[model samples]
Target: MEPDHEVLVVGAGFSGLCVGIRLRRKGVRDFVILDAAPSVGGVWRHNTYPGVAVDIPSATYCYSFEPNPGWTRSFAPGAEVRAYAEHCADKYRLRPHLRLNTRVERAVFDEDADLWRVATTGGEITARFVVSAVGPLDQPKNPDIPGIDDFAGTVLHTARWDHGHDVAGERVAVIGTGASGLQVIPELAGKAAHLDVYQRTPIWVFPKVDFAIPTPVRALFRIAPPVQRLVRLVTAAASEVIMVLGIVHYSKVPFLVRAVEALCRAHLRRQVPDRALRRALTPRYGFGCKRPSFSNRYFPTFMRDDVDLVTTPIDRVTPKGIVTADGREREIDTLVLATGFKILELGAMPPFPVVGLDGVELGAYWDEHRYQTYEGLSVPQAPNFWLMNGPYTVTGASWFSIIEAGATHAVRCIAEARRRRATRMTVKRGPHDAFTRDMRRRMRGTILAQPSCARSNSYYFDRHGDAPYVRPQSGLHVWRRARTFDLDDYSYGP
Candidate 1:
């Protein structure tokens, strides 16, 4: 059987769009970008809750090749970011190659033909190579609470937010106080009649340095595009200093943590005047253990008269409201689940079984053996299969840079395979194992590897308390390594 396409890219997000744009530039036309959603943007499309904006600075968040000149603020809002994703798809003329609302169910490797048999909601399609760009935090996580289904008033996850629902007069209950929760709570503070934020684990909150870009500045960016690129470079370098001092080299200089923690405390004290509320919001664990949120209004929102910070252990969810362990039931009309996503087990299976060599299901194999990828791109047995935001590939900052790095690496691999007249290309088992081992070794003594991480309810850890999701390295480190194409690392078959 002939292949449907030379390459099948599963997802149309930042990583997937990068693949599409780069493939077109590389003169590779036989490819299609498939997305389960009706639109292009992945998380940006789904998350449209009020006050939704990026945590990272907008300058460094964009592509190096396609620097956006029209960003209104230093930290762009979610709507603008989503529009940027659409702009990329349009600018690259990728719409012709996009298959929207088509979810890929399963993809199995055909050993004999050195091809992939991909099954989707539409039908079966085949490709010579399969690239999985399904993001790490795409799947929304619903809390394991009894009677969650019974909550009849209104139920919504932050990712699947219902904007039409009238939150103006409703008593809203927001579960979890992570990044999403912090952003959403501030927006709901004024609108909701009463906002009860359930905090199981307190997270460190710092001030957000967000400001609108003046018209003259934007005009200058439009005229001199290199000016914007220079700004991006400067922003990235500043973030790297924080990554090295506060995160990567934490064990060597422990005082760095104390200094950063003091700054966070000062920020909190300046915002919240009440001692009890300040104590409730304060995080006990060391900084960088879990993801710290950046917001100017998150702390001040708690001071509002209508808002109630609930620290009680939730026993279960009732139809009316939440029942606490102390038997106090706080009745609420709406439930907003800011609980986050399944990160560690990200994209393990996409609705159906991904059978690789010897009929090993990808999900079950990962559950037992954990992720085994060569530089978080190619696996040992999965030939011509590459994952975009795969295991241990996520850096400390500059997400777009990381995406670009992975996309370029995948594109290079495909080009090399074609040059060698190879039908199958897979990472050698030795190199794959060595990389995974090295990542584990490097994780030792880092902030995430410390015992304090257990105190924080972060999605970084697997079942055994090991962080299989984080790269534990700087963005520059991964970016440089990805650009360095080492052909000896892979094994090719004709």
Candidate 2:
């Protein structure tokens, strides 16, 4: 049977765009990129709240191939990141191949035909290959709070901010002190008449050394691209040192973790003078248990008289305000939910049903088998399907590195299938199992396996109590493995 397209990339985010660019470079033009959003940029496009910016240095946050030399700050703003995505789509000639506002509902494999029947909100389409690039953080997870719907005041999620609404002189309350909340709280402190911040778990806040990039440096990058590459290398190496030594090799290098914790504590004490507030903000879990944030203003914002940090547990929500466990109600005119995205959840990973061979659904398989993937790209029983961000795929390195590695692996398989004129390509179970076992063995050295992580309340650990979100390997090792992995691990058929 003839498929509608040669490949169907199931997202238009950085991961999807990277795969599309790779496919195009391979001279494969019969492909399409589908996204549920009305436009591109994925998370960057969705998150436009004030003070939204990259947590890492701008030098390391972008694609290695397409570095933007004109980043205004060390950490580029969300709008610039979105612009970069649009630029990539335009430069790579992916505009024509994009089908925006199209949500994938389900995908079922047709074994007899060796094709994928994909059902989307726009319509149904068949393709020879399907790449799930929906990303780990695409779907926003609303808080499971009682009487949330009964709130009469304006409610906004950090992921879906309402720009038209005016927040000035309004009594506002921000919930969840994660990355988004860290950035938003500072911006909202002076703007709102009175702001209340709800904290379920305190996070380790590191000092962000941010500054504007000089024009001459930008010019140097454009004139001599190698300079930017060097800068990127340095930035990446610094991140690798912190992540690998403090988190991945926690059992082996406990001192590095303690050093990082000490730095965080010193930064907190410097920014906040109130010892009681510092104690309230200090995290109970280990440093690497949950992802931390970098900010110069986050800790200082709590010192504002207009801002009040509410550590008390929220009992319920009234139409006008929030009720606490201590029989106190704080009236607010606006509510902001920084509850974060749906990660480590079955629904968000695929965001839809994907039926593979022998009536096995991808989510169901992960649920039963504990989320295993071969090289975090291919899986057994799922022929010609790849994931951009699969279980144990994300290294603590820059997201661009992860995307490039995953795309390389997926593209290599697709290229091999094309060369052999094979319609069905599935990873062998033996290799998959072996890889899973290796990852499990390496995971023992990471901080995720430590007892202190039980208090983290992190999304990294799944319901099965396994932190399969991160690959237990160095960035360089992951990149090398992606480029040189044995193709024989997969079985191709006509």
Candidate 3:
């Protein structure tokens, strides 16, 4: 069968939208965008957990195309984010070309014709190029706690909050101390009759300092995106740079992490007042070993007389509630799990299979090491396939900026390919080997490399201290490299 479109975008989020817009801007509209959800917003549509909001300022969180002058808050909420994505789709006129409710099951590359044959739940479609903008956090992962199914009352992951479930005045148990858990716990504290916060380790929390984006500020943003974007860039840079000292070189620069952690510990001590609870909630691991989170309200929630912080490991769950390995059983009517997404699960690596230069399946090779893509976009053997928000593309700043940078790179590659009438092009193994070695070399004393970090088996994983996935540098450096799109790094075939 013949191909369906020139380009097949596997998401309708900011990245996919940007890719579509860039294609249109270059006068190429023969693209089709497919999303499993019935609407445009991907993660934003699903993650409506309590107190959910972006930490980044509104300007950086938004698209470069359609800026909403009416941002009520400095850090936009879920609804506003969804609205912004929808608004951008409308502004760029990308909705007409998007197919909602279409779940991509698999996409295989046809070596002979050099096309991507994407099989969705609905049907099959093909395109010469495939853009996987499926952000890492899009897939919700359920914790594998034994006997969780036997829980008679309610169970829901934070990313897939069940609005219909009445959590008010009910006894609740929340598992996992990740970012999602930290964000949602505070919101649930007051409402639940009693709340049990199960923690393997405590997370580093700082003040959010969130504020309203007054009407005047919104007006300025809408009227001047360029100025707003500039300010956004500067602020994001400032924030990210401060954080770098604590994360990338934690051992060399222990003072900042210690200082910030001390501040958080002090915050907890002041709020909780009870030394026992404070001790239970205090983080033992090196600060910044895991992702650092911020919240004005999280510490205060623990002060509530009804909340309990259980640091003990779980043995199993009963028909009623959880049983800690310490031989204590705590019963609860509801379970709110915040165990974030499957960070390790790369959806069908190769994602689109590669019949490489040697006809070896790139999928099989990447299986040995979660997915390996050069520059987190192009694999060594995959031609004309780009992954947005792929491995290491995630940023502490704004993920949207990463998406924008990638879109820029993708368009440049597409333009060159069209110009040369190239049937296929793949990043050479030499460039990828050089880049990966450099990236891992720079990862040495970073948070992901600590001996204490090595001891822990949490999601802040480095393969029990062997393999690495997280990037070692700042997003700005990533942006600089991504913007370049070095054609020399790739080998082309006609």
Best by lDDT: 2
TM-score of each predicted structure versus truth:
0.98, 0.99, 0.93
**Model 2 per-residue lDDT tens digits across residues 1-494:** 89999999998989999999999999999999999998889889899999999999999988999989989999999999999999999999999999999999999999999999999998999999999998887778888889899999999999999999989999999999999999999999988999999999999888999999999999999999999999999999988888888899999999999999999999999999999999999999998899999999999999999999999999999999999999899999999999999988777766788899999999987887798989988888789999889898988778899999999999999999999999999999999999999999999999989999998889899999999998988899999999999999999999
Off by more than 4 A, model 2: none
Best by TM-score: 2
Q: All candidates' lDDT scores?
A: 0.87, 0.93, 0.76
Question: Which residue pairs of candidate 2 clash?
Answer: none
Per-residue C-alpha lDDT of model 3 across residues 229-337, encoded as one tens digit per residue: 7877787786676556777767688887778888888777767777887777677777766776777777777777898888889999999999999989999999998
Worst 10 residues of 3 by lDDT: 345-354
Candidate with better lDDT, 1 vs 2: 2
**Clashes in each model (backbone N, CA, C under 3 Å)?**
0, 0, 0
After superposition, candidate 3 runs with Cα above 4 Å error: 346-364, 369-371, 455-469
- For candidate 3, the lDDT comes to 0.76
Write down the TM-score for model 1: 0.98
For candidate 1, what is the lDDT?
Answer: 0.87
Q: Rank the candidates by TM-score, best first.
A: 2, 1, 3
Q: Which stretches of candidate 1 lie over 4 Å from their true place?
A: 346-352
